[model samples]
Target chain A: MTNVSAELDSRFRAAAAEEGLLDVAYDVVDSPLGELFVGISDRGLCVISYEADPDAQVERLARGFGSRVLRSTRPVDPARRQLDEYFEGKRKRFDLDVDLRLARDFGRTVLEELGRVPFGEVTTYGELAARAGKPRAARAVGTIMNRNPVPIVLPCHRVVGANGSLVGYAGGLERKHQLLRLEGALLA
Target chain B: MEPVRIPPFETFYEEHKDPVFAHLRRLLGQGAEDAFQETFLRALRAYPELRNGRHLRAWVFTIATRVAIDETRRRRPMASPWLHELAVEDGLPPHAELGHLTDNLPPKERAAVVLRYGFDLPYDEIAAALGSSEDAARQATSSGVRRLRERSKRS
Candidate 1:
């Protein structure tokens, strides 16, 4: 290896040594949008940032895990593997446990409501708020979505604007459109 | 640089997945998945233009690099020790002589060399990927190799 490569590898190894602290599990899942980053904990899938802003999301994740989050990539990441299967349409349901500790109360509540949004169908922002027992909080639902720690797993994209228009997806509206289309939820 | 046609999303993933992931992993250092996801998302949003397939790799790299650099600016974690070690090894004489001199450059230069040498891209492509001019990309890669040669001679 060249001197620069050697030095880079050394730093990488040093970071890898801290792997013991990062028990966070990860995987790459196939999505209608393409390959995606899916991370899980014992509770459920914790992080589901799209491919582009993965590190930004990782930094956000570190706040939840504290210093235990390490920097590394593993193809064998269970979450990624399962997600791959999921997007390939081979796996209809995910069995991975996720860490929900990072979710705030409203966020958790919104996510739970989102989970009820059966696959192959879609819901509205207001409808989701009503399901969450916050009928007046339709816009708050949008805020909850902006803060959603997990997207596809929680199915946040399944929720649309009150007017039934596709709007405000954190993962990008086109992805939201595509995911909805893939699940056969996009209305003509 | 050639114009790149954005293939059907599914087709794009199947054909370019490995190289794209490899690029993202290398560019972002860590958190490659997020960069990878973001890259496709951006592509999804701006699909019609990424035609021609000629500069497709460079285009993808450009997005990944921007996303990674943005993340780095936001979250500046120390490089992993392994990364440091790899950088050091790349500076050694044996590596330089092998023309494997590509490995240990600074992260940005390393990225440029990898895209240029490993992928056989032209300087324009590398510059586009890096959001710099061809001259800048050339300078970065040249300087990076020059430094490697200097370090190799000393070692």
Candidate 2:
């Protein structure tokens, strides 16, 4: 069996990108938290999950986007850079374009509002719900945070409970705490 | 009933890329690289809609065969009348390289012979790859082998 040479593999990726056949391009980047599986579509950066099984992450991307997902780092380079800056506390706000296609309707709305919560600020879930134009949807907003597809980019970690306690982070509350502390929203 | 689990395209591509490349190399030789890229690009474009993973090997091979045929026809617009005559009567030239010999066969026969002998795919799978009935695939393989054997005898 002839092994695919790196040159040929890169050529295939370039051709696929030119033909618009690469629907989702992803890469794994090292971060202060851990390895992040970053997935980007032509629209923008879409998935930013804490490292788990790489195969499982790719499968989820295939299910959400088209199955034309590939491991091309160039498409994800900007996100990686920004994430690195954020973890190092050198960047105050993410200037990167985020693809929220994985989240929809109210979840999309809440996440969008969450992005504007600033780098060193914290907001209650009820405040986020009100900003999303549904004050009664605080519980629903919490659920959306639990399923935030692009968490760090969307600032899901800045959200807290009404009692000012860290709660309902899908990546675990400890990660949420660490993120908040990194942004100086919580004391280190 | 449990739903069929279609593997991610990455997994699917990894599993089939080398074999598909080998099949295309047999059929298209130097042009296999381009045809191999086309086959996988086409596969990736249609991967999300695929509901069944059971026939993925056949599916990819089918794509590779079509790509090879298209590449061949593009290069030689009109089929060479002499090649057809040789296939029907005296067989291909004995000294011809295996790639050149197979390249001169009719598209279906070339695909059948490559899929069956080169890859050792079962006849039913060959039928799927060639998009023909199993009996037809069997007949094509036998005919293709006979032509190659006849050429060998003449040498």
Candidate 3:
């Protein structure tokens, strides 16, 4: 689905925050996968890490967003609700604004191609590599997916081994299988 | 001067809520909650202008003072005509202890005491917030403290 939300209008921002001039705000949200650390930049959702270490993630966010980050749920509630809906099989698409500044050059290009891989479908790393305009950079595509800042929402789990088998997943293969099974992409 | 980076509104709230809330609570008596909320809303609207990031705590308290005064102005006229609008205040009792301590002071003097002693705001900042000379701010606080002591001795 198309990304949703433009500028958070003054009215919404005013109610959502006290200062309303933060560089970024983040909070830990409950997911089917456990607690997910979500960060929303002033622009949009910028970081969603599979890594659950909030301190490290906060450090990284400070480095990226310059320590203007605080834990506020208002900006992140929409993203969290959509994720909940997805895991419950009620949503096939994420209609949320995403800021991809962290992903860059080859990695960013790879994620854009990964978005086209679609829901309830699977594709090969080598295939996605070619789609990213690198005929032989299958391993590089793997690296890109591995480092994906925004994972499940971006459908990184949809990429598999060339043998058409589920391969590595940052969230672990079990979660990957769980997602694929939920999506009905895998058959028992 | 190099621009000081401002944190997210959430973070700022976490760091500053206690002092700001306490300051507003003492000033507005029954309307403290409304004043507290409005102060932050006004601060949110003015955030971009504070990107320079000098004395943010004092700046916020300054905003809270303005909000408290504005709340007083709002409540004065509607006190009798619209009693139902005052229902929320009925639910949450004004902090009777602190309210009694400074209840006799005028709004400006109450603000001066709350800012100076309650929040430890400096004269210059308090004056800026009250739109008066620093000496006037000090006088207000002195007058406020003197009245509070007289009320305490008589009781």
Where is model 3 more than 4 Å wrong at Cα?
A1-14, A17-27, A39-44, A51-78, A163-167, A186-188, B1-5, B49-54, B76-155
Estimate, for each residue in A31-90, the C-alpha lDDT of model 2 and write its tens digit. 877788888888988888886567988988888887778887677878889888888889
Over B1-155, each residue of candidate 3 has an lDDT whose tens digit, in order, gives: 88776755555665666667666665655646556667766776676566665567867877887676556545553332112221232331223344335556897898787667544567886886676789999999888767766665676
Please list the residue runs of candidate 2 whose C-alpha ends up more than 4 Å from where it truly belongs after superposition. B1-6, B28-31, B46-52, B69-110, B113-136, B142-155
lDDT of 2 at B79: 54
Q: Candidate 3 chain A — worst ten consecutive residues by lDDT sum?
A: A1-10
Model 2 interface root-mean-square deviation: 1.6
TM-score of 2: 0.77
TM-score of each: 0.47, 0.77, 0.64
Q: What does candidate 1's lDDT look like per residue over A57-132, in tens digits? A: 4555544653223333552266666666767667655666656786678767877777777777778888888888
Deviation of model 2 at A9, angstroms: 2.4
lDDT of 1 at A151: 74
Model 2 over residues B42-120: C-alpha lDDT tens digits? 8878887788777788788888877776786677655522244344444545332455667778878877876665445
Each candidate: how many clashes? 85, 0, 3
